[model samples]
Target: MSGKVVDDRDQLLGEAVGLRQAGKREEARERLVALSARFPQDAEIAYQTAWVHDTLGLEAEAVPYYERALAGSGLSDDDRRGALLGLGSTYRVLGRYEEAVATLGDAAARFPEDGALKTFLAMALYNTGRAHDAMEILLTLLAATSKAPEIAGYRPAIEEYAKDLDATV
Candidate 1:
């Protein structure tokens, strides 16, 4: 990436993402701020900036930017999905369980193939006292991912939740 032209928007985004991954959050944020200034119409920059804020535990500051990203005219399906999930997570962290459930449920319907979406929805459901629904979703995920070796990564939590749900029933 060193020889690549940083002047390009996507390259800048890549660099920012790389910086974020390298734990240079301040630098990443600076890059995003510069990108936001340079391209006010670029929803991706706003979205990434909001994500950085969210990672820094600034949900209140992130919400408007996520809203802006959602409203931005030319976003692709992936960006739309990211914005939806980010907004839902922010709402969840803010104790808006109903909104989180509604937002994540909509995202799950829109992107049924996204395992992370299902997991997130399950978490929200479980936290909101809908453990049965959470268990059902987790069971479905386990079935779908049975062939993958890393299913074990999520199994314990799923089993614990399932037991809790069973006790509730």
Candidate 2:
């Protein structure tokens, strides 16, 4: 790609993210759409476009961008985690529970240090009627992060999950 197109894409993406953060969801989606059209190979733009669609409750529109981002190479670990989690969350929200479970399970395996992914996977498992497995995952995550700051951050939800798990099992 030319330097000019790259620069334009970067500027558009930055503006789109700022617009989304400022509660201008429609404007952000427009900018993201334009960016996606202009730079189809840009993974970050595709991912952000997917996010804008997600925030607007347009899961169907987001799926294409997410798939494009997933097909791209050279993503950082955080971006990979974000894409995986976003896809999983979207699938979960759309009632594709099995897909969410499988995707989040893969993400949890890849990002074992990410407490949030583990919690998300646990939720997917629980919601998919695998409460026992969810409980086991939560217990394992808590045990593993017992001394980390992440444990404290996830403690409240994790504890509530534990109670629900116990009730289910």
Candidate 3:
């Protein structure tokens, strides 16, 4: 792409982000949808469009854009991660438990250290009737968190919650 086109795209993305940050989500989504149509092959645009839709609670509309973003090449790792997480959460919210589990599992494999991804994966597992697996993941996460000095204070509560979950399972 030409420098001018790149500059314009960047400017538009910035404006959309700014709008969303300013709590004008509907306007941001409208602008992003227009930009996405103009840059149909741009992974960043697709991701932004999907993000706006998802943030607006339009999960059904977000799904296609997230899929497009994931399918496109040249996305940064952060964008790819965001797309996967958004898609997985959207699937979960839509009650597509199997799809949520698969998507979140893939995300967890790719980003093992991302606690949020693991948490969501556990949720998907639990929703799919794999409560034992869900509790295991949560317990492991709690153990890891407890080892960190910054959040050690929460360890007791976490442990208690884990015990409660264990009892239920």
Candidate 4:
């Protein structure tokens, strides 16, 4: 790409991000949508567009953009993680449990230290009738969280989740 084009893309992305941070999600999405069309091959643009849609409760609309972002080769690790997590969560919201399980499982494997990914993976597993596996992951996450003094506040919520999952099983 030309330097000018890159600069323009960066400026547009910054504007969209600024809008989002300003609580103008609709405006951010609109700008991102236009940017996505202008830079169809840009994974960051696709990811940001999808994220705005997802944050706006338009999961169905987010799905295709997330897919495009994931399929693109230019995504950074963090961008890929966001796309995967968003796509998996959107699939879950759409009741595509199998897809959610597969997507979240893959994401969890790629980012094992991310407790939120594991939590979502557990939920997807549970929804897919793999409750035992889900419970195990949650339990492991809880165990890990309990060992961290800095995150002690999360322990209660983790324990409650464990209790709820155990009750279901």
Candidate 5:
């Protein structure tokens, strides 16, 4: 692409993202739809399109965009992380629990300290009938990330329980 085309693409993408941030999601979605069609192979456009669709409750529509963004070589590390979480969470909401687990499991493995990924993964695990595993992840997340004074006092116990939720007192 020419520098002019690249500059235009960035400008348009920035406007679409601004719309999304300003709570003009419908407008953002419309702009992104056009942008995606215009720049089919653009990773940032694909990611933004998926994000807009996901925000608009269009999870099915978001999947291909997310997939394309991930497959693209140009996606930045941060956007790649967001795309992973977005796609996995979208799968969960769409009742594709197995896919959700697989996607999120991989994402959590990639970004081990991301609480949000683990939380969503736990939700998917519960959906797929792995309640014990789900609870373990949630409990561990709560123990490790909670800032409440109440939780602070119980962090040690919570950590222990997270390791073995089935253990008897």
Candidate 6:
């Protein structure tokens, strides 16, 4: 952060983000890499670097950077949420289902209102052969969030079924 004003650092981050959004993923990754070096303690930069690696299909390389970002406390609230989801999703993609479930479960507990986190956690739970648990989460989420007329009308039933799939007829 020394020798760089907050706005300058943010501008660099914005540039990297723009590159990623522009589909110049390699360039974004490069810019984030450099920014990470320049701001070694910057959680957001590390998180961005990790995300770029993930988008590039380099999940393995992204792990340490994600971990580094999460270990630091400099991330804003949204970025912290993203880091948790990113790391957990990366673990799932890497076939580390147990780790994914653990990480995503923690993230979901921390951000109960985050539907995305719950969705990913469901996937991880399924990967670990917790299909019933996964279905429960999915069903509850759907009941709570779906706007389809049919589902909307049956929200209470869906929620009840989500709690006990084996209920009597």
Clashes of each: 0, 0, 0, 0, 0, 0
- lDDT winner, 1 or 5: 5
The lDDT of model 2 is 0.85
TM-score ranking of the models = 5, 6, 3, 4, 2, 1
Note the Cα lDDT for every prediction shown. 0.82, 0.85, 0.90, 0.89, 0.94, 0.95
Off by over 4 Å in 2: 144-169
Clashing pairs in 6: none
Give the clashing residue pairs of candidate 2, or none: none
Residues 1-169 of candidate 1 have per-residue lDDT tens digits of 2344335888888999889889888788788878877777778888988888787788987887787787787678998899889998898888888888998999999999998888888888988998889888888788567766577676766566555555653
lDDT of 5 by residue, 23-59 (tens): 9999999999999999999888999999999998999
lDDT of 4 by residue, 1-169 (tens): 8999899999999999899889999999999999999999888999999999999999999999999999888899988988999999899989999999999999999998989889999999898998988997887787676666756756766666665665643
Provide the lowest-lDDT 10-residue window in model 3: 160-169
TM-score (all chains, Cα) for each model: 0.74, 0.82, 0.87, 0.86, 0.95, 0.94
Task: Write the number of the candidate with greater TM-score, choosing between 2 and 4.
Answer: 4
Off by over 4 Å in 5: none
Point out where model 1 deviates above 4 Å: 1-12, 148-169
Tens digits of lDDT, candidate 3, 47-107:
9899999889999999999999999997899889889999999999999999999999999
Stronger candidate by lDDT (1 vs 4)? 4
Task: Identify the superior model by lDDT, candidate 2 or candidate 6.
Answer: 6
In the range 4-82, model 2's lDDT, one tens digit per residue, is: 8678767878889999999999999998998889878888888999999999999988988988988897568898899
Candidate that beats the other on lDDT, 5 or 6, i.e. the better one: 6
